[model samples]
Target: MVTLRSHTREKARRSTWAFLPPEIRRMILEEISRQRRWSCASTVCKEWHAIVATKNLNRLELNGASAEGLSKIILQRHLVRQIYLNIELPAYTCPQCRGFASSSEHGKLAKDALRKLSKALAAWEPTHHITLELNAYSPNDTDHCFKNHLYGFKHENDGDLLEKQEAWDDQRHGWVKGKQVRLPTTGAIQQLFSTVISGVQGERPQKVPAVKGVVIRRQMRRKIDRLALPKLLKQFPNLESINYEPWRVLFHQPDLLDSSCERCDQMLQDGLPKWPKHVRSVTIFEDFNEQIMEAIRSGIDPTISSTSMQIENGRRTRYGLGEAFAVKSRHLEHLSVSFMIDARDFFTSCKTLSDWPRLRSLVLTTPLMTKGPQHRMSDFLVKAGQVAQKMQRLKSLVIWHCSHDEASAVIFLKNKRSRRNVHGSATLTWRGTRDFDFSEEVVETWQQVVCTCNSHRGYVGQCDSHQLLCRIERVEGEIISHGDAIHHLRLPDGVIDPTSLRQIRQEGILQREARAVEAEPVDGSGEDP
Candidate 1:
């Protein structure tokens, strides 16, 4: 089997790589890893495959991946550091995705798949940062557009085939309804965790496998089951960190409780459940309803109030929560609230931030530039700056979902810098919304090309058009601004246009330069001598 010439040929083939120094080989490997060329590199040789699999394949995202397929991947790459498991209902199926069909097929499938995944993970435990994201949107029916002609369809296990349900708000205006599907329960998700712990116990024999961190994004369908949440924490007593995202569901049903409805006997008897003190971070995205608006406007407690949790304005209410929302989680280091909590209320009610001594990262998001008045937004930002100054341990203050207001961003940056002392321990970033309305001034300043419609008509007046406006300050404000584009185009990062943003910045720079030139002395540099 080993002739001298044949062996020499094999050695020559391998020697190409072996001839290079180990450091040079490592540099080549790093370059491939940086480029995410794992699959290509693995095809080179067995030794290369091993090295690539061990180092480069660190983050695994399993969405609709089969249990057997997942097990093989995990077994091969035991060094995976993070896993994002996204198990969603098939855009259009029940028995197809799940194995059997029933009244509660979706729920059953979720529970079963989760159990199998947990078992697989337990069989081969890797130090992983796990994030579980489950989307509740139904695949078959996503047409939010309302067609007045299409109506009168019977409900079934599958959502109605009709495009939209119609509503006559008064006499003239017609409203189209969005998807009104019920939210899946956390009961199944909680059970999945128990299965994981049990499997870990079986494997370890004496001790359970240690979970590094878990982020759960669970959407509530009906009411948040008070008993289910407490049970989750009770089961996993060792979990030191958890980032929980809770959403109050939206659906249209006769028996469903709206904000206007009286609290049923069951809800009153069940009362509110106290969240565990150990939960390090919590996010609540409330439905935009009259109750929620009132809560933001007049400071009403959302839990006790009968508010229909319906989403509106392409955004949800974030600050319309009850007093007991996260009072127990004193150790919370990271907090993100999207609610329009008043600046005054924050300064007064949120004095407890000092209590959260461990708190470092605070993200507050609100649809201010897009929905609320400019005056209110300015006040809120001012108060946020004040709060940032007081928080001793805060490392980052992220104000997300701000409108593309250069003035506001400049103000925030100025305040942030002003607050920083010798150490300059804190950093703040203003994350503008990708979608922002172009001001009439900016629109007017930009030269317009000849309208295509006018090319045939030989008409040169501003093309008449209308767009879905984000927000208007006054009721008398013009809905359709003249000479402006009808529709707004958005960039990848959510801004309407990067070029327009750059133009705005350039204009500001030019204006400053002009002012500097105007202020300069005529002959010398002396001031009006």
Candidate 2:
């Protein structure tokens, strides 16, 4: 009983309360949470260990030394909640710091250990949310200098061991091939080669539990192979979004499907599967091949033809959409497309806006210059005016990264023409550099036209009765400029217009007052601006 009491006293001493107040302790814990490294907190005293474990702070990056360490943390439910596993391959470290050289036994052991860690994480559950970043290059393989050092044991017919070693070197062309000749048929070299080939082929579907999304950086070279893409897609049934780099879609001339439309039709029928109807959204970077394009064009459903399409600098082909391509998607609420398309082609593609009855918003981000100057500002404006007349349900129009001054001019002209018609009123939002201030010039020109029309004997602001025609507002950041005369404009209700002159003098007065107040130096300071 006395001995038990003594042991209990020692335990109590070890569990003594931390010195800092509760508030200070909380502040420290929060600070620790913000740190990138969790090992520092883990190394602290027993109380700190408990606190860190309880707080569950730190995004667990399972790579290098920490890969094996993850097994322990994952078992602790509280710690697992704090961690977001980032599974990356091991980096190659030199023998000096890594305490393992390629030639040494310890080096081999370390490599095996890291490989085991990778295998373990690959088998972990709830894999979907884990950010599995597969890098093509390992960190330690930095300069390609280490390739010279890897060695493999060899055998020779020569009686001398040194002679055998020399023979092996000659066969390998200097650097050792890390394989043992005496090993059984199913040796490490065969296994390694097979593993590498399988990895490249992506034949092994990584069991990612509950994966909501996946990002593949490298182009799946074998995607066209048997059951690759279909199998991969099956893994992510609940995938909401997939963001791929532009290079994934390789644009190759459709050699198999000649230039003939019938040939294109046959190839698509023979090669590609029907579209996955469940996939609501798909973003492709490369210009679609003729076969794919034909499949899209000739698809049975009108809705499929009307589905929102985005292209980048693709050559003009008679996509079977005919008039349907020009029609807005009744189902497609958002659409973004960019490329060098002819004005006539654009209008031809999307001529009937009435078909897209539910098309509420549209985004057109195309390069400004396309071919010659014949299809200039005036031509585009005339065509846009015709199209805008049909968008009866459009509520917002956003144009981003435009190249030519003509595009904005066309939009303004279209808006002006539409406003004159019975059904043309929508908020136009333009985001681009003010390289061409044609909107201001257009507004001024329109104002002059309105002024001249109203100047006639009986007309009293009758011709300038429209709200959009009367107000021309240009907003850049916080500052807004209207017609050439008004440097700034302020609205009475704090809502400025993009197309009229409304109380311009009040904006001037506000600016002048602000400048005057700013000019008066504060206290003993020098003159202010």
lDDT of 2 at 455: 38
Note the Cα lDDT for every prediction shown: 0.35, 0.33
TM-score of each predicted structure versus truth:
0.47, 0.37
How big is the positional error of residue 474 in model 1, measured in Å on the Cα after superposition? 22
- Per-residue lDDT tens digits of candidate 1, residues 384-422? 544554554554444433222211121121113333343
Stretches > 4 Å off in candidate 2 = 1-30, 34-36, 40-134, 138-209, 217-231, 248-365, 369-427, 431-529
Q: List the residue pairs that clash in candidate 1.
A: 183-221, 259-306, 259-307, 259-308, 318-339, 319-339, 434-494, 434-495
Worst 10 residues of 2 by lDDT: 520-529
lDDT tens digits by residue: candidate 2, 165-214? 33332122112332212211111111111111111232344443434343
Give residue 337's error in model 2 in angstroms.
Answer: 7.1
> For candidate 2, what is the TM-score?
0.37
User: How far in Å is the alpha carbon of 492 misplaced in model 2?
Assistant: 29
Using TM-score, give the best candidate's number: 1
